[model samples]
Target: MKEIMKDLKELMMKIDKFNSQQLNMLVEHIFDISNEDDILHLIH
Candidate 1:
């Protein structure tokens, strides 16, 4: 779990550094791959 958290933190920092184009693609990919729980968390 700590590893997951660490990786996710790294991912978020990387995401934060993305310019508009990369962030757009990332958002698109996230939507494409997200499961029900993931979608629920986002919306809620």
Candidate 2:
């Protein structure tokens, strides 16, 4: 879980310049995907 948190932090840093709407969409997409491999691919 700690590693996931680190990846999430890295992802947030990468998306820091995204607009509010884009960020919301990304967050929704992340939650919509129930597959662990897909989420890991996304975060990395």
Report the C-alpha lDDT of model 1 over 1-44, residue by residue, as the tens digit.
99999999999887787767787886787789659788667657
Which candidate tops TM-score?
2
Off by over 4 Å in 2: 1-18
Instruction: Supply the TM-score for candidate 1.
Output: 0.42
lDDT per residue as tens, model 2, 1-44: 99999999989977785667797999899989999899899999
Q: What are the per-model C-alpha RMSD values against the true structure?
A: 11.0, 12.8
* Stretches of model 1 off by over 4 angstroms after superposition: 20-44
lDDT of each: 0.80, 0.89
